[model samples]
Target: AQSVTQLDSHVSVSEGTPVLLRCNYSSSYSPSLFWYVQHPNKGLQLLLKYTSAATLVKGINGFEAEFKKSETSFHLTKPSAHMSDAAEYFCVVSDPGGGYNKLIFGAGTRLAVHP
Candidate 1:
């Protein structure tokens, strides 16, 4: 089975509003979870990650996510949204089972922050 799945392909939020992006994952071993954001024609930046160390992870630009092992979910959330937050978000997973880190990327979720 695919290791990572992003529940939404697109999400829209008004400026100064909250934003949420859903993701789920399945891994054989303890995995590292990451949320990456990409601006238009730009490289991706890591927003946050859960490495079996913390359940609640904080990230830059007022973003955060909680790792729920029981639910097998990691969802990104922001209390207030900004226009600059409009971009494509990816949920990534890294499994260290094979002695090497194998990164798996979700299809992607495009977030639109409106004015």
Candidate 2:
């Protein structure tokens, strides 16, 4: 079984400050990891993904994550925080054995950007 755990349920940051969202995963095989953001009244958007192509993966909107096999971590980071970045972020893991579409979603971490 593959699963993901969001370390923080809520993260707060001031505008223009650095942001960090931690995630840990457990899988029997080499798994794919992803970060998805869901804004209020909006659909979930793919922030980034790690599929063995690279350890460091960059995504849209100044977001990026590094896959660390030893640490079993895929933490999301940003240089600066923006008000627009506030949303519910979900750390996801793919269930390769089940199917490509089979995914395990974390509870979610709500990001709050204070002015």
Candidate 3:
């Protein structure tokens, strides 16, 4: 079983400020980690992925996350926040042991960018 916990349900930031969203995970097997961003009423777009390959993964829209096995964490970070960056971010985990290759999504962190 693989699971993810998003530390913040909501994050607010001023435009041009740094953005950070925290996440933690637990998996039975070596799992794939992913961060997905969704715009208003839109589908999820893959920001980055950690497939037992890279410890530090970079994603689109100037977002990145580091997979820390010891801390059991995969926290997303961005140098600057844009108005467009205001959206929902989901922390996901893929279980290799599970045959279906389903991704479990966190409740989601809603990012609000203030002008």
Candidate 4:
């Protein structure tokens, strides 16, 4: 079975500061990791993903994640935080047999940006 855990339930950052949301995953095989963000009144949006191609994967909105197989972690980071970046972020791992249909999501981290 594959699962993901988000280290923080809430993260607060001042505008222009660095942002980090930690995540750890457990999998038996090479795992597919993803980060999704959902705003107050919107659907989940794909932030980034890792599928054994590159350790460092970049996504939209100046966000990126590093796939650390050794640590079983794929933490999301941003050089600077923006007001629009505040949202509920979920760390997800896909089922090896189920493909895109089956996904395991973490508890989620709520990001709060302050000016």
Whichever of 2 and 4 has more TM-score, that candidate is 2
Number of clashes found in candidate 4: 0
Write candidate 3's Cα lDDT for 3-84 as tens digits: 9999999999999999999999999877799999999999999999999998999999899999998899999999999999
Q: Per-residue lDDT for 1-115 in model 4, tens only? A: 8999999999999999999999999998799999999999999999999988999999999999999999999999999999999899999998876545478999999999999
The parts of candidate 1 lying over 4 Å away from their true place are none
Displacement of the residue 93 alpha carbon in candidate 1, Å: 0.4
Candidate 3 residue 95 Cα shift, in angstroms, is 1.4
lDDT of each: 0.92, 0.95, 0.94, 0.95
What tens digits encode model 1's per-residue C-alpha lDDT throughout 10-111?
A: 999899998989999998777799999999999989999898887999999999999998999999999999999999999999977557787789999999
Tens digit of per-residue lDDT, candidate 2, span 1-115: 8999999999999999999999999999898999999999999999999998989999999999999999999999999999999999999998888555588999999999999
Q: What's the C-alpha lDDT at position 68 in model 1?
A: 92
- The window of 10 residues in a row where model 1 has the poorest summed lDDT is 95-104
Per-model TM-score versus the true fold: 0.95, 0.96, 0.96, 0.96
Cα RMSD of predicted structure 2: 1.0
* RMSD each, Å: 1.1, 1.0, 1.0, 1.3
